[model samples]
Target: MTIDIRPDDLTSPEMAELIAVHAQTMLASSPPESCHFLPIDGLRQPSVSVWSMWEDGALIGCGALKELGNGGGEIKSMHTRAHLRGRGLGRLMLDHILSVAKARGYTDLWLETGSMDAFIPARRLYESYGFSYSGPFGEYAEDPNSVFMHLHF
Candidate 1:
């Protein structure tokens, strides 16, 4: 697929709606009270950067990077539209996210993902990208449902 990945304003109408839909879907499919979906407005804070992926004019996926200061970064809200799952779109997204993290002089990249059967694939993907299991970072406290992973770039 001819995909184009670029940074986008989190407040863009299209992206805002897309993120809402993605968050709703994620929460709906999640357990009783999982807080897995990061809110769009929250991600629009000055320290964060968001990106949307497009393939031949169709939306493919979106991901965000947050500068955690001290040259550390975090990955937030990585999602591929349901219709376009598989076909290497995820690899593309990860590659782009990682490259962006590196360009910002981030020495470490970390992420928090749910630890559920639905998250197995995501865990696998992060491992494939060399992200290893680590203790929670940022505001997260250890939870049986949360898996923290990080990479030292």
Candidate 2:
């Protein structure tokens, strides 16, 4: 599949569906208090850069990078359509996010994900890309259901 990942506006109808699915998945995987998936409107904030992957003109996945200032960034809203999982699309999206963070001069990249079994693959993927376990950073607070990871360039 020729997947095209590009910056996208969160207001698109396709994006709405993607974000809704992402939100639903997060909620299903974690408690409401532990879910950090940002809503579509939040992803449109000036500090967040959103990207969507498309193949044959159909949206297949999406991810975002949030500028944290002081040369830091946070990965947010990363999700692949349920049918498209295990196809290396998540890795491709992550690689794109890391490249953009580097090009933007971020010295560190951080992310928060669920600590449940469902998130093991994601944690492994981040580890393969050099992200290591870390304490909560930025505005995040300690949460048993959350796992934090970071990579420094």
Candidate 3:
């Protein structure tokens, strides 16, 4: 299958709907306070670069990398369409993110995801990429509902 991942301006109707679904899904799976998925406006920041992944022109996944200063970066808003979860789309997007981070000279990458069983797959995915458990970083604070991970390049 052919896959394409590229920078997205987050203006298309497809992206808007996908982002809405992503936020709603996160809120439904985790408490509002525990869900840290950024809103569209948040992802549009100057420091953040978002990418959309498509397979033969169909949007299947999307992810973002936010420059956190000092050669550090944060992975944010990673989501693959629900029905397409096991098809390696998430891994594709993740590999793209890591590649971009490394190419940009980022020394560290971090992410925060749900600690609930619903997120086990996600945690495992990150772990498989060499991300290790870590305490909260940047503006994040410790929370039982959140699991933070860090990867050093």
Candidate 4:
């Protein structure tokens, strides 16, 4: 199973559907105030770069990297199609995002994921990649429903 990860313009219908599904899942699992996944408009900002993962011409997952300036970056909108979980696609996309961050000379990477039981796998995934618990960065405030993490290169 070859999976291709490439830059996406956020125009494809499949991508739109995936983003909606991602949003729905996030909203359902976490409270509205704790959810931070970007909407399509937010992901389209010049500071953000989005990528889609595909297998055999079908969209499988998507993730984004947003530059926060001053050598800092943020991970956003990471989602693998529900049916395709456990296939290591998230790991692949994460490695891809890390490579991009390194190539851009980012000194640090931060992310905000839910602290809910439903988010354990995501937290574990980030932890596996060296992301340690951290105070909120960017505009985020400390919240019980959110788990903030940082990885420094």
Per-prediction count of colliding residue pairs?
Answer: 0, 0, 0, 0
Candidate 2 structure quality by residue, lDDT tens digits, 65-150: 99999999999998999888999999999999999998999999999999999999899999999899999999899999999999
lDDT of 4 by residue, 1-153 (tens): 789999999999999999999999999999998899999999999999999999999999999999999999999999999999998999999999999999999999999999999999999999999999999999999999999999999
Best by lDDT: 4
Pitting candidate 1 against candidate 4, the one with the higher TM-score is 4
Candidate 4 segments exceeding 4 Å error: none
TM agreement with the true structure for every prediction: 0.92, 0.98, 0.98, 0.99
Per-model CA lDDT versus the true structure: 0.84, 0.94, 0.94, 0.96
TM-score for predicted model 2 compared with the true structure:
0.98
Give the Å error, residue 90, model 4: 0.3
Lowest-sum lDDT 10-residue window in model 1: 28-37
What is the per-residue lDDT of model 1 for residues 3-94, given as tens digits with 9 covering 90 to 100? 99988877667788789877876776566355656788788788888889998887778988888888899898888887777777788889
Q: How large is the C-alpha RMSD of every model relative to the true structure? A: 1.6, 0.7, 0.7, 0.5
Candidate 3's TM-score reads 0.98
Candidate number of the best TM-score? 4
